[model samples]
Target chain A: MSIKNFILFLFLTAILWVVTIFGQSNNPTLMSQWIFDAYNKKEQTAKKIKGKKVIVVAGSNALFGIDSKILSSYFKLPVVNDGVNAGIYLPLILEISKRIINKGDIVLAPLEPNMYSYNHKVGVQVIDYLFARKPLFFWDLSFKEQFYILWHIEFERIWKGYNYRGGSPLTAGFYGAFNIDQNGDQINTSLKFKNQGMFKDLERHHKNPEHYGAEFSTEALGWDYLEKFVSWCNKRDVKVIFVPATLMKHPSYFNDPIEKEFYDKKIIDEVKKRGWTFIGKPHNYMYDSSFYFNTNFHLTQKGKIMRTRQLIKDLKSSLKK
Target chain B: MLFNTYQFIFIFLIPTVIIYLSIPREFKIKFLILVSTIFYSLWSVEHLLILLSSIIINYFLARKLENSILNQRFLLFAIISLNLLPLIYYKYSLFLTFSESSPILPLAISFFTFQQIAFQFDIYKKKQQVKSFEEYLFFILFFPQLVAGPIVHYKELIPQTKEKNWGEYQKDYFNMGIILFSIGLFKKVVLADNLAPIANYAFANIETISNYDAWLGIFAYTFQIYFDFSGYSDMAIGLALFFGIKLPINFNSPYKARNIIEFWRNWHITLSNFLRDHIYIPLGGNRVTLPKQAINILITMAIGGIWHGSGWTFIIWGILHGLILIISHRFNWFKIPSPIAIFLTFFSVLLLWVIFRADNLSDALSYYTILFNFQAIPINIEFNEILLLSCSIIIFFLPNSLSISQYLKAKPKLHWYHSLFVAILFFIALKTLALAPAQTFVYFNF
Candidate 1:
């Protein structure tokens, strides 16, 4: 067969397979089960909380970042710290940052510093936000970048859930509302985790959340590209608050002043400068070791509860003002 | 831009091909050079600088080496050092930074450093010389083997840069690319990626898993590395052919080899050749005494391990392979048939992959403890686990490593039936692209 005919056949076969696969009545692949859980987990956590005030913490592997139930109960506001550790390539933060806005909404974004600078991470999110959120805008990007964005559809699944596990039916990605209890504290460290590299990262966070801190990773003028977002929010009067959530660990002394300056002067200082309510307390290290899920960076039930109560009070006044 | 990514295959590869084929052949080399730099820059803008610097420094020095009045050895060493300096800077700099003492690492340092060192060796020997910058640039930057390589010899590639015959190019070039790309896609997307989770889970938590799981994890990693590296080599060779260049075939069914000697010949063929030619031959190869020969192989392989990564695990892996070679030479152990030797080599190599895949030496030791001390081998594999295992096994055991055109020489009759079968398989591979494209070419890091 001619090369043209060969290519044509392959293209047809691809289209046919995609059609058949998508056409099949399978509820969802093993991956989506996690997303469904994340979305539902956030909704259910919010729905269960008794108050109108809410804190929406969004990111990749929402389970990895913080415990959900403990924060919810303490705040009276539904607490959904559904942040996956997926790099910025995922549009979850960018997308959720736009959609789930409200008058009393408190948005907390805590991620690794390396994540922000990656082309793939930021690109993935930008691409998805461009196409899925607003299609006409995707064209403005260079064709290659837009083209790359088109392929990363799982930003939805990756951003919102524990998609990595592909676990059993009831707990596809939601490992039961971040099981914050005594027994859960004793995690199964027996499984020799390949994530020793990650442990090193946590060690960095543990020693000093300041140096190699995620806050330093954020841009100085992050009300950036938010000029459009800010104006849009102003017209809608969706009182927006940007809270750089504390990971409950105090940064160590080794954390240089350069990094500390970047966080204090750039991230936290900039967020406050933007007039968004900032929540900072219960430094990550002071809490008991068990209050952490994996490392010092994330909060355990005690840390989450303490922070959430402070958030409720902070948001009440911010909203009132 | 990752060789393992679908975005590279579908978005970059396809469009680049369409553009190349549409353009005249005179512009093809330049087009490819442009595409290759673009492909490289996707990793980091910083990485591209290293690539361009390698191209410029070598191109100028190579010409001077060909024409200069200076003693060739000193110039050769200078040029070789110049080539390797960037690699040391990019790849080892971080190591140096963190160790607060070691050297900096160059991006794709292993590839370019070894490549330029080979080029310098060739120049010293007067084996090949290029008069034109364009040919030199193409030799350095040819996309197929650029980032990851089957390490095309300058002699083979520079001549092809001069050829602009569109008719021959149209006939075989793209056919080779499609088959190679599809196979590579299958290796990366379907095979390497699928096995990764099991390999990752097993290797990571080696302490927690039973002895049976440890073995399972090691074997999974072994196959993952093979399919990942060999698969990349295949893609590199296939893509080289598309540009009407034939890079030396890097993998030749290494898993099927009966002994360590044969396995090295089959795995990363060019690197082996480089080590043999430069390191081994210089150190008296097999012409020396048995003990000296053993030292040569051990030293060569250990450095080979260090060449793979800065980590000790890689060095140990190299040392293990070298020791296997020496012992096999000395006692002539595993005096078995070809089939059994092949399996044993594969199994032993698979066992060693535990070290290669582990987070560090301690994890490797813990895994080894479980694997060796286990009471029984487990037969049970969960469905996803089994799927990955079976896929990894199939990727390894499969005989047809070469894409059709590599073996076929002239286009064997492009039968419609074969074409149709190829079509069905290609998109089946395509559908798997979105399943967490974490399938990086294991060799890329090396």
Candidate 2:
């Protein structure tokens, strides 16, 4: 084995990797279906909302939890559900908020626990890179976020593309199995019920100490973005109300309710101090664990009605101010 | 930058190796130290200072020990303690205080500290002497073995660098390095990293893991640690070989060993040798009475475990290995068949990995309970996980990377099929690494 031969081996391997990477990148079938649907929903929402309507900006919690038709009929305005999968971090959420938020528009954002986690933010950005593959979306991310995307997702796809030749079969099955409406909400009640046991496993997995057991922090970059978002909305004369997403009440998961309440109060106070609206107490959105879908934040049909009705009351009172 | 990353391989290594190969012999060592320093500093500039300070302090101390024959023992103890001070402060500070917000452990502090301590001890014992501070510096900070190491001794490494044609590229070593590095990269990216997610999920959600899932989790970690560390060691050796220096063989299909004694001999061979020569032999080794020898083994293994991380779990894991070794040595009560012996040895190793991989004692305890409980539930196995586990089994039977490199030397011209196989493996590894999260080598934490 000579040095020249070894060099030749390296050269040939590099060429193969580059060719495969470019070749894979060109194939649209390589994109995960859920990611494609979410990207499509993101691009179409601007055209769908005709008037200065009430816009819901959130993660998958809102996409699965909110019934925009119910909100639109009740609020007497066009409602755009701009919630995508929660994997997209708060920076992108802020970018989305800034883009669609016009003067006199009402924005309802029910924040999930993931919005405040750095790890979750990276998870969101990874999804954006893999599924959306949008240049402007990638550009909109912080330099740190962009670097993470390059290293973790795009770099990963070059190799994963070889094995996952035509994209994720699980995601493809879901694309065929369930439904995503024109408003970008996942309307898969039957599928959700069918995978009830799997949902429990997922819920338990998410509740693991490694995932969310650490105490929530106010100093997260996500929280910092929250403050900036409120300020941006204030200057633009768009009414922004920070609300709590409907959560499953699992005592084992929320072991420290007192600490949770303290954090909630602190967030509400911060939002109110910025001259923005703070609607619905955290307790108002807590339901029995059975009233949820897969995740803690995703509400069941009955749970959504309970949450939506309570939210309507809160909004009526907050708007009066 | 990690060995498995594009940044390290393409952006950093390939160009550096070419430039390093082309340079004059005199500049080669200097270039390595500079790049190694840069590599160490990538984690933190402050940590790099700490590494430099350790080298500077140890270099002068070794010189002092060399100069002072009468007070060599005293200087050795003081230097050893001084060497251990930073490691103790960084690695054990959080454990001592039970604080959540402790400082980060400097990467490879344990490894470099041990390597330097060995050098200083050799000086104190008058077995070796340093010719120059630069040679000593290169020996201590050589990037290939710098972080996690074969713990290359002063005698073996320094003389190699001083060879007349040290800077000139040897075709055989270069080619061997290429195959070894590629194999290591494949082992890491394709084999170990793939197993990580499932293993992590099972361990992280311990309550959800059933009896079969526990087996799956430990097996994943068992092979994960093997490939991860062995892979890193091979890369280190390969990288060193690129500069025409050979690092000691660190792994040799360790899982194939039929007994605990054989396993230690094959696994982390350098560390095992370091322990045997420096730690175990100093404590009376096997030359003493049987019970005393047993005690020495326990002490050595316990210390070896503590060298890994700051935790009671690691200590327990070490003690279990020591006990297993003692039992294996003393007992000939039954003549177990080779297959049975290998299976039992592997099974014991698998169980021990649970303790090693768990976050804490309680975490390991919960996993053990689930493992033995035998709950009649469905095993939550993923499609890729089964494939990975099947692939991992080949590790026990296949000729290791080092041996393959040896074979390549004799048979320099690779068959077309062999070339194609290596190319495909390398291609898959590269692609997987691109798509996956940049996983730091498991040993790097030590």
Error of 1 at B117 (Å): 1.5
lDDT of 2 by residue, B147-223 (tens): 89989899999888767778897776776677788788888887888778778988999988778778777778888
lDDT of each: 0.61, 0.75
* Model 1: per-residue Cα lDDT over B16-85, one tens digit each: 7778767877788788888987877887787678678777888778878888776987888788777766
Instruction: Put down candidate 1 lDDT per residue, A59-144, tens digits, no spaces.
Output: 43234434445555645555555453343332344444454455555444443333333343244334323332344444444455
How does model 2 score on DockQ?
0.21
TM-score of each: 0.64, 0.68
Q: Best-fitting candidate, measured by lDDT?
A: 2
Over A218-281, each residue of candidate 2 has an lDDT whose tens digit, in order, gives 5666766777787788788887877876656655444565446544575577567656677878
- Please list the residue runs of candidate 1 whose C-alpha ends up more than 4 Å from where it truly belongs after superposition: A22-321, B68-70, B89-104, B164-169, B330-335, B377-379, B392-397, B403-411, B437-439
lDDT of 1: 0.61
- In order, the TM-score of chain B in each prediction is 0.91, 0.96
